[model samples]
Target: MSRFLFVVLPVASHLNAPLAIGQALRAAGHEVAWCGPRTDLRPLIGPDATLYPTGKRYFRLDGETGMASVRTLWEGHVLPVNRFIRDAVDRAVADHRPDVVVVDQYALVGALAAHRHGVPWATFCVGALELTPPDLPGFGDHVRAQLGRVWAMTDLPVDDAIDLRFSPYLVLGLTSTALTGATPLPARCVLTGPALGHHPDAPAFDWAAWDPSRRHVLVTVGTMAEHLARDFYRRMMAATAALADRVQVVVTASPDVLPEPPAHVLAAPRVPVLELMPRLDAVVSHGGLGTITEALAHGVPVVVAPIRHDHPTVARQVTDAGAGTEVAFASATPADLTAALTAVLDDPGYREGARRVGESFAAAGGAAAAARHLAALAARPIEHCPSGTAALA
Candidate 1:
């Protein structure tokens, strides 16, 4: 059995996909371990899973927008975290001695550590940030330059051929072409769709409270965007208020955000999202990849109000696929949200689009496919090609 070590960010969306994949590998008799903060990893992964803790550190974007958010993510979070956890990751590798290191896209140090140890590694593209379109010229180049700088900072020789962001062996993109449209990706990249699975830490909700007589709508901006979502939630409540008799809006937020939500709205700090998806008819969200993909996997349509980071890109993909509509996050009025939400609910075409994407997700094999690929990579012989590039041969 091959040993696999997953080096990931502490964020929920980033951790979920790899967790699912790790579960799959374990089911196949492979040993799996994770490297991240213990407090964050323990609850989600359960007590049995082995963990190499990097301790706790919080990284915040503080509501930046567009390219600035991208800069903040790399400069403020990714780089700093990489520097902070480099020693921990090195120790994990030295001790765990994993045959394959599964590296999150943003966790550059994982790839570097694997390379240092001469271990095969795979890239987990949990979001749409790395799948930038041609229209955004130099975006990929800029990201690659950042990766180069990280390597240089480690005093490691920068092999231009080796892009640390992606593994030459395997890259598991947690999305399908249905959402990504015609965006080009790396040759080694496998669109494994979204690894939709159970989250052990998901909070339970009172399913009995749900009103089946009216259409159900979920309004959430995911975990990271809560600060930016207070105003968005206000706008969403205003938008859905008129339709309260016909539609039930479930807002996932702290009571403070919606202290006295209308009678028709259900407010919560967290909800059983996967369990609740089948009951949902439509979702109003911040265009997060995890929320969008999970909703689509259940054949539930979405109305995206992109907040920041990869939100706009994922929003465009959803709109382009005809699976949903997007609105300005900061400036979109209640009227805009009302119209968008109404269109997805009223129009059968949007549901059909979501259904098609959902079918594609099923065909893509999700976590099982990722696990199979990692297993194959583990068994394959790593050889230097004619140009001195290391790859599975």
Candidate 2:
């Protein structure tokens, strides 16, 4: 049995995908270990695998919830986080001495470690990755340029030979072929779609409890950026009140990490999206990829109000695909939102488009296909890698 190590981000969505893969590997009789911030190790350690938690402070923030806050931290932490992961992953690789390694898009250090050790490696990009092709090596320059607006630091001057120089095997973008009409990429840089784990078995809630007589808008900024949605969310509540007879509103507030909302909106705080998306007529969100995917997966039309980082990137994708409307933060006034959502919900085309994309997302074989690809790649012979001090690849 081959041995492997994984360096994954310690978030619910990000960690879930890689942890599932590691568990799958263990089920197939391979030995697997996880190395990272280690906030949640239980998910990575199935009956067969080992969990390694690198002791490091991931982020320091209190009661901050919103897309803006999440964006701020990610931007500021990239360099420092990369440095920390690099050191920790290097040490772990030396100790575990796994034959292969895997990481999330955000886990740069593990990728570097695999390269240094001459082991096969893959990066599972669970978000909207820069959509450049593998044949074009210099596309990193172009990617940084365009994505720079959303992730301002990415567009800044840096060593151009970063992404592909280290990882030539699999930059598995969370893209489904059915949606983009883009052909599958080479083995080294395939657009293997999202690998979400089976969602938690949430307590079943009554969807019929939400009345359909009035317009219903569910507001979610994202797990990290629930704070940024406060203004838009507040506006939505006011609009629902103004049109009380014409609409009903519901929101699952971000945990205590974010402040309580205005009483007009019922803060069903901690209601997981899996329980809520199926009941919503439409979603008002900061355009988190995961949220957008889930909403569409449930055939719910969306009005995207992007804040930072990949939010705008994902908004453009949905718009380009004719799946939703983009509502920039500057123009997200209550009246504007009411009008925009009214138009979108009234239009059958948006619903049809969302349904089509959701079908495409499903047809592309999300998690299972990713698992198959990963298993195949892991079984392949480890590639020869260059030697270095084992810095961030």
Candidate 3:
């Protein structure tokens, strides 16, 4: 059995995909372990996972604007973490000596370490937007210029052609082409669909309590999104209250955000979204990739209010895919939300579109397909390492 080592960032969206794939690999009789900040993986990834702490956390933030935030992510978070994690992963490789290293796209440091060690590695593209579209003029050039600076800071070798963020062997994308548009992927990039991993701490709720008489809509801005969500959620709650007679809203937010929810609303810090998806008529969210795909996987349509980062792009994809609708997040009012929710619920086409996309996701093969691909890569013979770039002694 081959040993697989995963190096990932601690954010839920970044780490979740690899956790699911690793669990599948372990179940298939391979040894699996993770290297990252030890911020508790048991709740999301189960208790059997072996942890190797990297002694630092990936920076988490919200409520930031466009270009500035993008710059901050690369300058403040990505670059600094790359330097720290490269050494951590290199040490882990020397000690554990895993057969293959699975590297998160953001955690490019892991890829560098694996390359230095002459180990075969796969790139884990946690988000669909991680790849630069080949046809976009100047987009690829601009990103590579910045990435070169990051490589220099982290003391890693640079490849001039395509960004080294993608692995030469394979890049397993967590999303499918149906929702991400028909952009042609690099030859090594494989779409493994979304990773709807098992949630061990799933909260049990009274399903019987849900009012079958009215259409159910779930409102969420995701865990990290709450920082920018208070006003947005207030509008959502007000909108749901306006349609109280015909619609019921179940909101996933902190208690402090909405201590006194309106008559037709149920507010909680955490809701078992997967369990609730089957019964939900629609979802209202911040257009997070994980939430969007999760709702789609259950064949439920969405009403997205994109805030920042990849939100606007993902929201546009949803509209283009015919799975849902989008609204201006900052200016959205109760009336606007009410109208969007009504359209998503009242129009049968939205549900049909969601199901079509969901069907595509299933066909793409979720975690199991990713695991199979990783297993195949690990089974292949190890390639000869170039003489100069040997592992640090």
Which candidate tops TM-score? 1
lDDT of 2 by residue, 144-200 (tens): 543332222222233334453235666666666544455344436665455555444
Q: List model 1 lDDT by residue over 183-296, tens digit each.
A: 788869889899976688888787788898999999998888787787888888999997998999898999887789888899998898888899999998898898999999
Candidate 2 runs further than 4 Å off: 1-3, 20-31, 43-49, 60-75, 129-166, 177-187, 200-216, 242-248, 254-264, 387-393
C-alpha RMSD between model 1 and the true structure: 1.8
Better of 2 and 3 by TM-score: 3
TM values, all candidates? 0.96, 0.77, 0.91
lDDT of 3 at 252: 85
Name the lDDT value of residue 38 in candidate 1: 94
Which residue runs of candidate 1 sit more than 4 Å off their true CA positions?
A: 133-138, 384-388
Clashing pairs in 1: none
Order the candidates by lDDT, highest first — what do you get? Answer: 1, 3, 2
Kindly report which residue stretches of model 3 are placed more than 4 angstroms away from their true locations once superposed.
Answer: 45-48, 58-62, 132-142, 204-209, 382-393
* Candidate 1 global TM-score: 0.96
Model 2 RMSD vs true structure: 6.3
Q: State the lDDT at 40 in candidate 2.
A: 65
- 81-110 in candidate 3: lDDT tens per residue? 877777778888777888889988878778
Give one clash count per candidate, in the order shown: 0, 6, 0
Models ranked on TM-score:
1, 3, 2
lDDT of each: 0.86, 0.63, 0.78
